[model samples]
Target: MSNSIYDFRASRLNGEEEQLEVYRGKVLLIVNTASECGFTPQYAGLETLYRNLGVRGLVVLGFPCNQFGAQEPGDAAAIGQFCQANFGVSFPMFAKIDVNGDNAHPLYNYLKHEAAGLLGTEAIKWNFTKFLVDRNGQVVERYAPATKPEELTPAIEALL
Candidate 1:
């Protein structure tokens, strides 16, 4: 894949076109989320991290997915409402996108290629999978669906 994750673009929940370039120079945590998944509550911790680290150059990006167990079956509006009401999430959230299969988003494709999970496996097995990127736009780590956002504090601190 290419070195520039900024080459990709995706639509925001509000239908606004967002270039990955907008996150340039910021360390990012990209997550595939599901509203009803077991890991769904991570949104709270993610939001906390965002609130704490955002001023220090951290940007958390959430992408709601329904590909697994149909947990995130809601449309963009519903998903946004759920996150706002339950988690009080203030991070940037994008429209639903498959993180695996033939139609995976291009940004996810690059992330998987850059930092594959255990044994260098590129597939995202379930929701809440995370890809951490450095300020230079390079994917630095891939966390499993079970990895909680708080567990990544050390790694994120190191990058900061």
Candidate 2:
């Protein structure tokens, strides 16, 4: 099993394979996103955090998922275009992938295992669920889907 996110590779929005190792020393806010969800506007907040704190080693990684309510039906190209057009998202975004069940992405599996959700359950409850990682690549905390991205500034700052 991979010991950390740095050990895994994911397909970027453009279909390029990227090693998470590139972010080895960065604090990451890994989020599972969906375009049609109620929390979709959090994209703006996430971007604000990324733009504001990215210089300090914060990297917000967005991974779109459609597992809940079929919210993200768009393919990679559409998802990318939608994010850029709607929210001006500039942070790195990956191809859509399942965040739960058998087809779950390996990186997400690792995150859920390392940091279970509320009630200690590992299954992701919804889109926009966020996971924070320290610069060392260890999972630090898991935030529910309802937790606003700005609300995480303190925790993220602590890691930076």
Tens-place lDDT per residue, model 1, 48-114, is: 9999989999999999888899999999999999999999999999999988889998888888888
* Candidate 2 global TM-score: 0.98
Tell me the tens digit of each residue's lDDT in model 2 across 19-75. Answer: 999999999999999999999999999999999999999999999999999999999
lDDT measured at residue 142 in model 1 versus the true structure, 0 to 100: 89
10 residues in a row with least lDDT, candidate 1: 1-10
**Candidate 1 residue spans exceeding 4 A from truth:** none
lDDT of each: 0.91, 0.96
What lDDT does candidate 1 reach at residue 51? 97
> Which ranges of candidate 2 are over 4 A from the true structure?
none
Local distance difference test, candidate 1:
0.91
Report the number of the highest-lDDT candidate. 2
The residue pairs that clash in candidate 1, if any, are none
